[model samples]
Target: MNLLVICKASTQIGFGHLIRSRTFVENAIEGNMNLDITLCIIGDSSLKLLLKNPAITFLFYEDENQILLTKSYDAIIFDTINFNKSVFDKIRFNAKKIISLSPVFNLMPFVDICFNRTQYWAEDIEKLTLKKYGGFEYALIQRNCNRIHSIIYKYGLEKRYFNIAISMGGGDAANKTLEVIKQIKNIIEPFTFWIMLGEGYSHSFDEIVNEIRKVKKHEIILAKTNHSMWNVLSNTSLLITTSGITSYEAAYAGLPTITFYDYDNQWFLLKELVDTKLTINGGKFSDNSINNLRNILTDLYHDRSVLYDMHKRSKKQFDNEAANRIINIIKEEVFKT
Candidate 1:
């Protein structure tokens, strides 16, 4: 079986799509079936990451039209919204199966399967002629590394006490991370802060790091890209992150997270998750919200039962077996088609 995954990774878009696509490819190959996987990435950094995997072929394209002229495959999975009807029409006749992962607001007529993890399909499924696999479970990672170690091991350093992780996706579009860090600095005692600065933060990354370092007891570790984010998730006790797929990943790791929903797209989903007790709605980075956040964290640190209950709910929501179920669905729907 030949599978080609098309994904985009940029400072503005973040690395979630590419990361999830890689997870899918990795699991597909682990079946011991004769599978040939290829990745068509949009960004140079994403291409470089794909090149690290010797088992898969890598192709970089400036536009979707370029891919239309290329050789076809058994299955072509699109992880980006850049490809539209014209591009899909070009390849629809060539590929045996066409799957779109996490499409934004639109559906392609040429697409045979749609795997949406954002709960978008529950509203409208009759308009498209495709197999709809929708829900948060689609964001599951194939835990090739030891799940226990991936969650617990950290770079042993004497300064590893009470490390608070602040990750606002790979893009950090609204510059929410910097604001969150600033708020944390106001009320808490100094602790090591692992700041996962994505490629998008390159412009002001140094300045932010330096500013955060001014505090006597804070250490800022900037990570541009990490294949094993689960490792970082496991080592941290408290997380302050944006409400996205990462929120669910943190939950699976049993990490109590405070998610902020500032974007219009994420408002409803964030509200739903918070209402379910899966996560706390740490209001956006604002003057008024800072004090509330400080109070919540202070209280949470002392309440062991509440923390444990939250962790239990999160783990239950993000089951480890989600990957296996996805693979099974692909075999039954995609492969059969």
Candidate 2:
């Protein structure tokens, strides 16, 4: 089987879609699915550093019109933010099966299989012609999910100081990290803040250090773009992050997650989790709801039960074998052996 992983990753888009696609490709190779895969990410050359793999051939497309045309792939998988209708139509010209990963709101009606794993596919699935893999059962877990979650799964929040993490995706183009950190400083107590910055983060590391030095009551640990957030988050009691994969990872590690979304898909995820008591919804940051988010955070700090409920619900929300499920889908649906 020949497969094409078409996705997008940039400083502005962050790395959620790219990371998820990479995880699936990694699992496909490990499982020896008799697959020859090409991971085509539509982004700059910088993304190459983040997706280093010797087994899989990497193709990065920076030019808009230079989208690669494939002829013999058995299937093409899309985990992109915005794939034009013409581009999507062209990719499926020769492929037998077209599979889509969540968030699938935009590409739902256009694919053969909808790995409609999370909140994005729930509302209107009955209308789409795509074969479904809806609900949390198909939620993708990180390949290292077990090891990462084990760091603090059993004994949650075992760290020395009260640790709170602020992560607004890799690009954090909006620079919400400093805003979150500043609000936490007024809590009137000593706490440690671990700020995870992505490669696309525009601020200087020196400036972040200088800001922390002025307020010595709290310590700030900076985890650069390629840093292992799982390790840092495992020690944290709570995480204030963008509504992305990191929030899901935090929940698996048994940490209370508070989320702020910048896009439509993220808002969909926030609504789903918040309704389930799986996360504290800080609402969309783009709505100019910083004060509202602050008020929610303040209330959450005083309410440990709310956080704990979110933690327990988070663990139960996912099965952690999402990659394996996708592999089975390939064997059963695409290959049809």
Candidate 3:
């Protein structure tokens, strides 16, 4: 089988789409399904770093015209907002199956199957799809990265002291990570801090490293281009991150998390986490909300039972086996089509 995946990644949009698509490819191969894969990404750096398979082909395009040059695949999986009906219609001539992973607004009606894991699908769009699968049914893209699992077990994370991970996605578009570090400077003492900044962070790398140096009594480690997030989350006791798929990853690893909302697009995932009490909004870092954050942090530090209970609840909600279930869905939907 040949699969073509269209996606994008950058500092502003982050790397969730690329990461999730990679997970899909990984599981497809592991299922012993002989396959050829091609990735169409917007950025060269993201394409080069994210796609590791030698058999994989890469293409870079900013518009729909590029779709005309591609050969037909058994299926085409799109995970970007940029792919509209025009682009799909151009390629639909040869492609046997058209699948979308978390579409932007459900504008494309011809899609064969729509896979939305977070229940973030729009009601109007859901009604238009030929077939729609919703909920946390297929979000488990982690099983694709075998190296991450090995790293998790090798890191001795299960036996470590309290471990806290701070991740703001592939790009820290709002530059809120440093502010988050400052807010927790005093409170996170005695905790091992693993900070993963997006490769596209706007601030100079030096500036971030300097700030880490200023923090006292905290072991701050910077992570770059490493796929060890699963291992890091597996051993982590708590997490403070932007509300995105990483929150789901933390949940899958059974880590208690505090989430910060960075953009309006992030609200869907944030709403779900907030409703479940799996995450708390660490108020924005602007002057208007800074005081609110200070108070929330103070209160959070004093309430140990609330923190513990949140962690316990998180473990109950997210399952590690989610990847396997996602794989099963692909087989039943896209491949079977």
Model 1 C-alpha lDDT per residue in residues 1-337, reported as the tens digit of each score: 6667888777777777777777777666666367677877777544474346666567787555666546767777788756656766777666777777764535455677777654554334446767777666776554532232322422321132566678888777767777766766665544567787664564577667766776565566766656555566566666788766677667666676788766555465565567668778887656677568778766764554565567656656665555566656656765663
Candidate 3 residue pairs in clash (backbone atoms < 3 Å): 152-231, 170-198
lDDT of 2 at 172: 78
What C-alpha lDDT, on a 0 to 100 scale, does residue 296 get in candidate 2? Answer: 67
Model 1: residues >4 Å from true position, as ranges?
Answer: 45-47, 103-105, 108-110, 118-129, 142-161, 188-191, 213-225, 268-272, 283-291, 321-324, 334-337
Q: Which order, best to worst by TM-score?
A: 2, 1, 3
Residue-level lDDT tens digits of model 2 in 1-337: 7888888888887888888888888876787757788888888898888876798888888953588684668788889757777767666776888888865446668778877556455456566777877666666656655533543543454443567778888887767877776566665455677888877887776766666667756787888746466666776778888888776666655677778877664466666667777677777775356666656655655655666566666766676677778868876887676
Candidate 1 Cα lDDT to native? 0.65
Pairs in clash, predicted candidate 1: 151-234
Ordered from best to worst lDDT, the candidate numbers read 2, 1, 3
State the displacement of the C-alpha of residue 134, model 3, in Å, after optimal TM-score superposition: 1.4
40-155: candidate 3 lDDT, tens digit per residue = 77654544665666755677775445556447777777887565567666777677777777546344576777776676655557568367766655665476222223344334
Alpha carbon deviation, residue 149, candidate 3 (Å): 13
Best by TM-score: 2
CA-lDDT, candidates in order: 0.65, 0.72, 0.64
Task: Name the 10 consecutive residues with the lowest summed lDDT in model 3.
Answer: 144-153
Q: What TM-score does prediction 1 earn?
A: 0.81
Estimate TM-scores for all models. 0.81, 0.87, 0.79
